[model samples]
Target: MGILSDFFVATPEEALRYANRIEEPDEGDEIEELLDPVQYKRFTDLEITTLWAILEGSDWDVDRHALEYIEIGEDNEAWLNRFPDELTTLLARLEPESQAAVLEAWAGTEELACDPAELQPVVDDLQRLASEAAASEKSVYLWGCL
Candidate 1:
């Protein structure tokens, strides 16, 4: 089994509940975890690389620094919050082709065992979450467990 990541648009209050694993019967809140880690990695790598490419358009290589800005979970588990500003900024700079290229690169590489087609929905879901977070002035978080 590989890692699993949960991506969500959580309000400040909602974030607290998920982080603490606090359960409220009436709240009916459901956190959406991606289907699998292999698929999730596509979103993770592509999002980071695309952001970097937009910021540093010259000679950007995904393999050279894919994990540079990406934070890893220290204890088989970790959470990273992309604040509204961060989400908005990156969202503004991303291009459609850049995202497609990232997906293509992942498919072509031997490093990951994933079908390129499977990653598209994950990408769409992430964008939806990011959009919701930005509109609501909330944060987007990637929670992972191995």
Candidate 2:
């Protein structure tokens, strides 16, 4: 199986504290308890490079703004990364139509073609998460497992 990813909003300290905890198989209950009302979305197989491209409308440059690795599993099968504030701001600022357009473009690029219609919920969740993160002065963190 490919990577299963969850995008969530949390402060740096909170994210690091719960980074490894999220990999547990408790269906995120522990995380919810720890973060209390955590805002997140399960978006599998969505790579940071893809998000960078979609948000910046250009090739991803690691030097410019990369996903900052906060923690890594001992076996190297999982990790937590923090999203750059700029990308979060960019996503938070996208209009509804622009979000839909991004989803349509993403569908076109995926190996297994997805219906943009089906991705509306994902778009909405991410938009809401980004906005909430921005408003609260927190960052978006990705928890990925393989």
Candidate 3:
């Protein structure tokens, strides 16, 4: 069955959105532009750091091709689409907790630095270890989380 057939979202707009994925060929470029010079330098340096982190401890031998996904320029759908033994290798090397921690660290260092606003919480009951200072203010709350 197709996605729309299985899902119960009310509008075509919603269904189409669920079917779509965010394309970020120039996502890094945008990030770089929005950041100040020092921030941009930090961002680039972090990219190098993420590159090495994904490289050195990874389970598989990810080639120059797969590394493009982590990079900021050019469409990388071709390499990203097909199933790779490389992904299996990468996942096999790390536990789910480790994976989440690594992602959290990277996102916190780079993505979080760009937006001082705050991160939308993963779960309300999941317990964030931060003060609720801004949680009372008007801001975005992603509703799709379980």
Index of the highest-TM-score prediction: 2
lDDT of 1 by residue, 18-63 (tens): 5444234333334323212112542443454454444344445656
Pairs with steric clashes in candidate 2: none
Error of 2 at 138 (Å): 1.0
Q: Please list the C-alpha lDDT of all candidates, in the order they appear.
A: 0.50, 0.68, 0.27
lDDT of 3: 0.27
Top lDDT model: 2
Which residue window of length 10 is worst by lDDT in model 1?
30-39
RMSD (CA, angstroms), candidate 3: 15.8
Instruction: List candidate 1 segments past 4 Å from native.
Output: 22-80, 92-98, 106-113
lDDT of 2 by residue, 1-146 (tens): 56666677888877766665655657456665756533333343344557657767886555675677775558577677777787788878888767777887766665426787866666676677789899999987777767
Per-model TM against the reference: 0.56, 0.77, 0.24
lDDT-superior candidate, 1 or 2: 2
Considering TM-score, which of the candidate structures 1 and 2 is the better prediction for this target? 2
Task: Specify the poorest-scoring 10-residue window by lDDT in model 2.
Answer: 37-46
After superposition, candidate 3 runs with Cα above 4 Å error: 1-80, 109-146
TM-score: model 1 vs. ground truth: 0.56
Model 1 has an lDDT value of: 0.50
